[model samples]
Target: MSMKNLDRHNRWRNKTVAFRVSPEEDEQLEIFVKLSGLTKQDYITRRLLEKEVVVQGNPRVYKALRDELAAVLDELRRIEAGQGVNGELLDTIHMIATILNGMQEEIAYGN
Candidate 1:
């Protein structure tokens, strides 16, 4: 190809952006970076540039899941109000949130 054509092709390629992240966030991102088979920078760049689609869930499924989550929160509140909270339960909630967040990110950004 001609030099001009090669330059044009290069111009159409994606550009990079740089920013700092917290150490904890960087550790989490590293997990996803490996899972996605992408470098951390490429994964972050692609995710930032990607378009997202938000689909409405099945009404019954959505309602059931919402109710279940509410019930968990309610139980958590009761535990908090009573005397103390279970560390295991709190950890489970955090893990669930992380998983859901990762799935959401994949759905929104994955090719």
Candidate 2:
């Protein structure tokens, strides 16, 4: 048998929740999770619970940010070459901006 799990509040987490998303949605979720530097389960749980997802800066997160920025640059170039702006790209940009802004605030506050 698999080991049981408990949440931060020491509540048992024995229930399973599942849902289907389109491939595009799945891709977006993956990107967000990677950027958040949180496990998929933790990311989804925090989001579902409407809890603040404070990202602790780490090497993995920095790498994800770099990769995402590169992808954003590529997308921007494609758009400049006559492609249309896609919502997914905008969402990625917004998320990245939010993360960066938070990091900046932390640095300013010496946190």
Candidate 3:
């Protein structure tokens, strides 16, 4: 058995919840977690609990954002002129936009 873990509230986390996702879904999840600068467990927990995942501005997150943007650009370039855009790509773009907007607001407010 694995060692027990405690949450920020000092509560024991003894239960294990597992679910399967498609490879594509797993990739997307990983991208979001990295961008948020949170552990996979913490990001999943906050998302499952309907809590806001507030991303802190950090070097790691900045790197992830830069890499993701580059990947997105490559994908866009690969698409044929008449081909439809990928929904996942749109979703990723929206997410990145939201994060950037929030960061800008934080800077504006001197937070």
Q: Which candidate is the best by lDDT?
A: 2
* lDDT (10s digit) by residue, model 1, range 6-109: 33237533444578888766755654444344445556756787933222234543454455467569867888787677554465455446545765787898
Q: Count residue pairs with overlapping backbones in model 3.
A: 0
Q: Tens-digit lDDT track for model 3 on 1-111?
A: 334387778788888899999998999999999889999999999999999999998999999999999999888887855567888898888889989999999999999
Better of 1 and 3 by lDDT: 3
Instruction: Give Cα distance to truth, residue 88, candidate 3, Å.
Output: 1.0
Residues 1-111, model 2: lDDT tens digits = 233487778777888899999999999999999999999999999999999998889999999999999999999999999989999999999999999999999999999
Local error of candidate 1 at 96, Å?
11
Candidate 1 residue runs with Cα over 4 Å from true position: 1-16, 51-111
**1 or 2, which is superior by TM-score?**
2
What is the TM-score of each predicted model, taking all chains together?
0.35, 0.94, 0.91
- How far residue 6's Cα lies from its native spot in candidate 1, in Å, is 9.3
Q: Each candidate: what lDDT?
A: 0.54, 0.95, 0.90
What residue pairs are clashing in model 1?
none
In candidate 3, where is summed lDDT lowest over 10 consecutive residues?
Answer: 1-10
